[model samples]
Target chain A: MSDLSVLYDAPGPKAKRNATIGSVVVGLALLAVLYVVYARLDEKGQWSWDLWGPLLDPSNEVFELVWQNLGTGLRNTLTGALVAITLSLLLGVVFGVARVMLGRWARIPVVGLIEILRGLPVIVMMFMAYQLLPALGVNYEPLPGPDAFWYMVVGLTLYNLAVFAEILRSGVNSLPKGQREAGLVIGLTPLQTMVMIQLPQAFRTMLPAIISQMVVVLKDTSLIMFLGQYPELLYQAKIIYQDLGNTLQTLVVVGIIFIAINFALSQLAVWVEKRMSRRSAGKSIDPIMATTAAPVKV
Target chain B: MNVIIDNFDLFFQGFLKTLGIGLICMVGSLILGTIIAAFRVSPVAPLRAVGTLYVNLIRNCPLTVVLFLIAFGLPTIGINQSYYFFGCSALIIYTASFVCEALRSGINAIPAGQAEAARAIGLGFTQNLRHVILPQAFRTAIPPTGSVIIAMFKNSAVLGVFGVSGDLLGNAIILTGSRGFDPVPVYLGIGFFFLMITIPAGLVLGYLERKAVILR
Candidate 1:
């Protein structure tokens, strides 16, 4: 019984004991490095303490600048994400269904759209949008604070819709034939069966992948910084760093904040995916947070 | 048609520039990425840590900032490189993170028994890895790294402003945006040019994935 326990764990009791000691030694080493870093900051005492210590100081101008920008940035980020999420899902439905139901005359265009858009680098898409839209006479310039906002949203949607089409197509394809046949046996139209039976179950299987793709979308909004037009949270951090000549510290804060946002989004994705997968598999609702970076099927 | 016919030389020139920059960035990144990937997967813990921190910092932070810092900011402190090297350096570091991760995933998929068997032959770590492990790992790594390469090719566009002069989209911007021609067709044309590269890469990757079916 004891041997069984030892076999299952990577670092069994003996290895664990050794690793523990090793971890302590490494931890102390890390502390020594931090101490050196702090001591170096003391040498450059003017910038270091002011910059690094701003997180605690509620009244620091840097914190206030971040706080103000953060609020507006969050609102703008959410707005961009909202528009993207909405537009992508709509296009996903259109193209995804086309992939399933339409012939080549219809499907080729959709397929081309997916290929071009998905092939696009996210940053280039934004850059292209910024340049392309103004030249296209899509210049509804009557609206407010830089039409690049709308362009960014549209670009994100274009890329996402292309990828989401993959998720949707796969989901719909994975539905067993019997469900469609059963609907036909009940004298329902093929379209009705698709709407009633197939799409629902397809969505259930695809929910996780779709949600994960939203993280792809969320992280992408950071790409808007390329335009140098949008004062996003990322841009805001860049500003402070550029202003204060404290690039590393500002970036640390920026990275931590981005990670927190991505983490939260990932948690939500995991939650939805778990429910959908569990229900599809007809298992007891385990609600496991499957963070396994498992191999995607080729 | 006349628009292109008149400037066919310039267009071809731009196309060649785009391809050249893409190829240069691709080769540079793959070499740098492979070195970092090998370092990351090395047995030496400190080497792995060093490589991982490099990847994390480069990957999570924006590439644009790195390019700007290197391109514009460096001159202020008296470090000077041509914009070409700066662009290539940024692209190499940034895309290397993704390439390293993709390769690492492929390397990880290699069964533990392979390593054990290599050890069983009394081979040292480097020799065992070289002789027995890496060839198999390369096979596994091919599909994902292929896609990463394709993605990296697409991403090389980001380096356009850092001195890929006569490149497709950047040149289009400099040309049309200055001349007041509609930039839409220029970008659309550029996007199509990219598709010519990316689509074939995707197909090759798909074919390789099918061939390398560990699980099918």
Candidate 2:
């Protein structure tokens, strides 16, 4: 059941020779592309020590300052993600349950809200919140951070709650009808059946997807830097690079950090999926990979 | 409301630009993504590794970082382009990873027996993929690819702040930041335009998904 063998026959002597040739050609091609990129950067004096020293050289005073700025930016990013993750999960469960369990009168509006939120871009929602919050007399000075921080949190939460709700709904929908029927026959109310049986099962089934969505939330926190005031990772990278004139190096560093965090989260999701599928004897539905899926992060 | 009415031309132009970017990137990503999918599924180990590395690296980094690398970092390396070009490139590159995944998943969904049957019929590797695997894969890939493209369109809104003028968000900024108009109406108008694109696209994709279901 090897994936490769499904596509073609296992190689004979001739096919093996051809595969070796193909591998060599592709390997050389990749190396050539890498070399060209390196050559171009080197030609532009991009390898200058002055540009790279602050980020790479620890003894320099600027190195410490740059790291501190990046550290603060990382903290701010995680804080915003943390708040949005918590709030969105809560809203997602409520709205997700409502969409499934509520009467038509209540569910339609919930459906409408989720659809509208899903349709609009997160940045637009953030800009709207940035403007609307102050107008609504929601003073920011008393809050823990700048006005843009709250704006970012609110906006991320709004969009993600819709996504999370849809994910949960899909999770529940994928379950066997027998689960709910059995609960009803056992003398449980619909709400009780949902809370006691379906909801917990959905949570377990959708945990991988929910975690991956958190990765999206973390990445989205960078968009708030566009608000021009929030000192998130990207914003702080901007400040450091502007001072050091090492835009490329600073961004590469920031990019690596983002990749590190997100890669860890994605691996966790894969691990959770594996464990859940094993525990359920391969019965879990992988909504994340399903076709016609919910609105996943861009 | 008055601001939206008065700046109708600007908004319209912005709307068109957003569509232009989305359409161009959608096509670009589809082509690139298909190529990457071929690489991933091909027998060559190096090609598969390259595809895996490219997908993982791009998918993990935020689109904003990708945009910054293209828009700002490229210039320092003497590869400057218009912000619009950079914006489109960033979107295409970022979106292609997800597109590749969607397509790869589609390819995987084809029953192993189908591929074996193709091989049994004396089809070569490329022939088996082109005639048998791909046709079925496209059917399954359509729904997820549509979702990815829709997400890409919404992502085009981020181009506004990156100095790509004449998109919906860019025009919204012109109204609020410079002309001193109300942000509420301006963003609302923009939101309406976005909804106009996404909702219809979603409905069509849903229809296609239903149609694509194999009776077997």
- Whose DockQ is greatest here? 2
Task: Tell me the alpha-carbon RMSD of every candidate.
Answer: 5.7, 2.4
lDDT of 2: 0.86
| Candidate 1 chain B minimal-lDDT segment of 10 residues | B69-78
Residue B192 Cα positional deviation in candidate 1, in Å, after optimal superposition: 2.6
lDDT of 2 at A269: 86
User: Residue-wise lDDT of candidate 1 within B1-216, one digit each (tens)?
Assistant: 355556567667777776787788778878888888877765445556768787656654456555655565444444577877788777777777767766676666666766766666666556766887677777777765776677667767776654656776666667565766565666666776777777877777778777876662
C-alpha lDDT values of all predictions? 0.66, 0.86
For model 2, report DockQ: 0.64
Q: Docking quality tier of candidate 1?
A: incorrect
| Model 1 error, position A248 (Å) | 4.9
Q: For candidate 2, lDDT tens digit of each residue in B1-216?
A: 898899999988988998899999999999999999899889899999999999989988999999989887667656778888899999999999989988987887788999999999999999999999999999978878888898899999999988898899888888888899987788889888889888887888888888887755
Give the per-residue lDDT digits (tens) of candidate 2, residues A140-172: 653235777888999999999998898888778
- Which residue runs does candidate 1 get wrong by more than 4 Å? A1-47, A50-56, A127-137, A142-144, A174-189, A192-208, A238-248, A263-298, B39-43, B47-59, B65-79, B111-128, B131-133, B161-164, B210-216
